[model samples]
Target: MKSYDTIIIGAGMSGLAAGIRLAMFDKKVLILEKHTIAGGLNSFYARKGRKLDVGLHAMTNFAKKGERGKPLTKLLKQLRIPYSELALNEQHRSKVVFPNKELSFTNDLNIFTDEIISKFPHEKDGFMALLEDVRNFNEVSLENPYESAKERVSKFIDDECLREMIFCPLLIYGSAWEDDMDFSQFVIMFKSIFMEGFARPEGGVRRVITLLMKKYKELGGEIKFRSGVSEILTEDTKAKGVKLETGEVLLADKVLSSIGYPETVASIKEDLEVKPRVGKLSFTETILCYDKKPAELGIKDTIVFYNENDAYHYRKPKTLFDEKSAVVCLPNNFEIDDYSDGMIRLTFMANFDLWENLSEEEYKNEKNKVLEASKDIVRKLYPSIDMEPNFVDIFTPKTIKKFTSHHGGTVYGSIDKSRDGKTPVNGLYLIGTDQGFLGIVGAMLSGISMANLHCLMPAGAES
Candidate 1:
């Protein structure tokens, strides 16, 4: 019968963020994680001495050190992390290849704008106007199910190509529901990525996770690894604490579920349960270790969104891969001091049901098919790389399910955008991807924001 002011589930980005906030406020906080280590999605796995960064490619909402009012700066302030310690590397540029056209955006807005104007001279007005709309777009909290990304953008822009292009990067970064994303979700993604651009941590995502863990521990917050909540303890319509799989009960004034909404609700022992209407959208990524250098191949950019002339559905694919872009990323391309053998990650959206019903042999066959196709695509994208992978590992939806226990193996969690973490059950809150924030930075912000409102606010004051 251990008691604390708060019990946070999962030690992922959001969970760690919430724990750090609670500890900073001098609240007795404890975080329980099922895995032995933290950074659930944005974690790494060692294979043959090379640490593979599993989920994080790059952090969105990029801001330079000491740049006030920016998302990155804001996060650093809340967590009390020094900007010099982060040592972020700005990406030179990123590519977005469409069926008939392509675009490139750089860390410099002038260069990004010039590139767009140079290519599509006639569509210059439309593109510039759209940028203004994106900057002035404050409709992040609008709750209209009938409105979608396509609905809002189409009102101002007339070009079908440019319209789809506007959604290309955002959908690839934060898509949860359908090809046409929820309008509010789109605004947040646009602000985080396009408006803010991207930056890479010096030691990658693990560095950020390590910093949060350190801050939480320094603040006297406790974290229990290999501990999982089997059931949520509730009585008289209010959550009391959690019952661990070890038959131990830890009481708390409130609980923050960073795992997910539906998954948390179903774990409650009471008759209260809510099922998630998932989009069946998931992903398959292949990590390849080659024997060549990126600079040797004349590869100027670190990442390429290679669309083989297909409109990005950004949702559940009909087949393994349809007319969509292959997200090809060179994780080691950032400005790290050391250089090693090449590591390339190729990912694409897929349907969970497409492989969920496979037999053992069927699953093997399907996995091989995707691997081979992906290898061919990698070679085609970089013809002069002299590619020879010493290690090739592919992770499908089954892997996602095994790691996160999410329905449909969905990495984006649920599709609901209006959920504000407050559930029908009192004293329970939801955060992370399910709470409508996407990517590593978004998840951390979601956790910190929700905790400040629901957990730290005054008894009679507005949250």
Candidate 2:
């Protein structure tokens, strides 16, 4: 018999943000989470006395306090959270390594531009033109049509190598499509990673989650952990409410789902006209803990996008995992080293179906291989790192599926994004990854934007 003004599904970045926004406006909001914990994908776990973060390397879209028009500033302002609470530390620098070429960049855009100009001297004008294009494009517009990023970027840059290098980090960090991403997504990632750059909260992602939870509760928002939604109850193609896995029904005037696009469709029994395909991209990450920090080992880079060949293969692997390419993150290389011990996280593209078909013992053996490969990559990148890690943990696509419940362990969600957040069913909306916004900042923005457009707008107002 109970009803809420709005019900937000999943306690991920987007869901929590939506709940907080709705509650701030005095709307009775309820957040239903399937797991006991919050921070659905970007969460943390304690294992053998060590706290490890999941799905966080470096938070992109870093901005200084009170920086005008920046994503980080806008996010905090919208959530009414203070920038000081985040305690963010900027990255020292990151690199993109492809065969004989290596380009280094920091929080400064000039450094990246200079690197490009220094290496690809002939393409400086083209690069600047591309940057202008990215700046002028209204990437956030809901009505914009999808265009191939590679094709568009090629018009600006002549050399294929420079283009591949440019896209290495952007594609791996945000794209749902293989090899390339939408032009709009490309611009978003470009500005966030290259222009604004990376930073990390002092306590990793947990601190951010804690702040949102505290803020939401203070605003009188309700969140039920372990309350899994079994079905989105609908009538006449309109959302009625939701049926929990426990067979309990809760009514809501509107529903916002952050789980994913395809997953959302699967929850409803009605044969809707739209059927979004699940994204094929997945990853396996190897976490290594060392007694000595990376700086002590003479490593200065915060993160490195590594590729053995000229081409960057940012897609699902045919094998268990792609060994030639990886995203190696040195957490200790940040401006401030908060961890007691050094840590390195290596992420490799993986095939979900291959990992899902393995036996228990086979899975264990495959994980060991991934760990060895990770160590090999470290040795290759840092030849001085000869000692074995004190602790090592590897997670495959199966782990991603088990924890986040994203089909195929898809990190970026469905390829068919609902840019406007509107579904075929009235009173239903999509946010987070499937909504086309990416990273921690993008996810929160998606939630806030959707909530404002759908629930907070005045009667008869345009969305």
Candidate 3:
């Protein structure tokens, strides 16, 4: 059996990041991925000669200067990956259309504030106060559980509509939770997305994964695809190795699981004394529609938020699709182009259990129903464009579970600011969306944080 100093389960960004760092330290590392690809959520698939990303609509924290100087750029520099900026049009920076009125959010805070003031002059003070809260929340620096963030925003912003418009969508993007989510978790995301501009890689998010994989391989790290780990071997209540699906056992000194919190815990065979609440949490399901490119659809590079009103309402379990939701547009480019046929991608929150119960046949029918409903929502936003899409792909919680091996197919492993993020399990480290923070940047940062902790500990130190 092959052996190494450490074995990382999952080849997603967090796992790859951990491998790159460990390999750099001259430690032998092996990454086991169940899927054929390496990027996890960052990876993409090809259909009819075109590539479609599973998720990853856009990114922030890639900016080189100003607010971008924090974590993301620092990691890229360490990894020796080079990136360039992609500009957004001033007119369509970000548009949010509610039932009663419309608001435009720009990269420039002053421009964005002025636009909001123009539309709702009566609520200018309230709007400015809300912006101040977001800015303050973004500026504060704290450790993993951001206790200050939760306190600050709740104390300052009392208007439900304003909070719903400004912070609710961010909550959706961050944790599949609404605005009422823990403020500290929301603050980490706010700093990443708002302080930094929305960005895409030169090729796409897949390129980010490819770059990391190349670096990992160059550092002599090993990766085995289609080799799923069925169980984690343990001795004396400590992790020792992993058992693969093929009945092959490999030993290692340490094991880091980026597959998400629940699945990772389930893989551990030992009946450990300490068990944290990692498996129970909610998730956001995404549906993607692709085609040659819709004609006469004047799209922008911006993400559009569609809702009836901006009110922060905490959604109960299994009630994800009940509320008024936002539809995000992910197009090739924002500008009107005739050179090539275009494709539009739409994503929204969905019910996990609802989709998991459907059979293959039932899934196809339910997928059609979701597509039709989504199409109607999109048509209402962009009425000028035609509604016939060439292809439709729906991903439920089960899909995420099957592909990523995350418990409950949760986009993130576990909800943040909860007991899970701080739960101490000997020899088992948890990172990625399940640890609380979401988004590409958040996942990478979490991995880096865990790596740093591991690096500081003494040999055989309990983590």
TM-score winner among the candidates? 2
The TM-score, computed over Cα atoms with residue i paired to residue i, of candidate 2 is 0.99
Sort by lDDT, best first: 2, 1, 3
Q: How accurate is candidate 2 locally (lDDT)?
A: 0.95
What's model 1's lDDT at 266? 77
Off by over 4 Å in 3: 65-68, 84-92, 120-151, 176-179, 273-297, 309-323, 334-340, 416-424, 456-463
lDDT (0-100) at residue 180 of candidate 1? 78
Q: What are the per-model numbers of colliding residue pairs? A: 0, 0, 6
lDDT of 2 by residue, 1-463 (tens): 7899999999999999999999999999999999999998899998989888998899999999889999889889999999999999999999999999999999999999999999999999999999999999999999999999999999999999999999999999999999999999999999999999999999899999999999999999999999999999899999989999999999999999999999999999999999899999999999999989899978899999999988998989999999999999999888898898889999999999999999999999999999999999999999988889999999999999998899999999999999989999999999999999988999999999999999999866845
Clashing pairs in 2: none
Candidate 2: where is the Cα deviation over 4 Å?
none
Assess every candidate by TM-score: 0.95, 0.99, 0.86
Off by over 4 Å in 1: 139-146, 320-324, 337-339
Q: Which of 2 and 3 is the better model by lDDT?
A: 2
TM-score order, best first, reads 2, 1, 3
Q: What are the lDDT figures for the candidates, one per model? A: 0.79, 0.95, 0.63
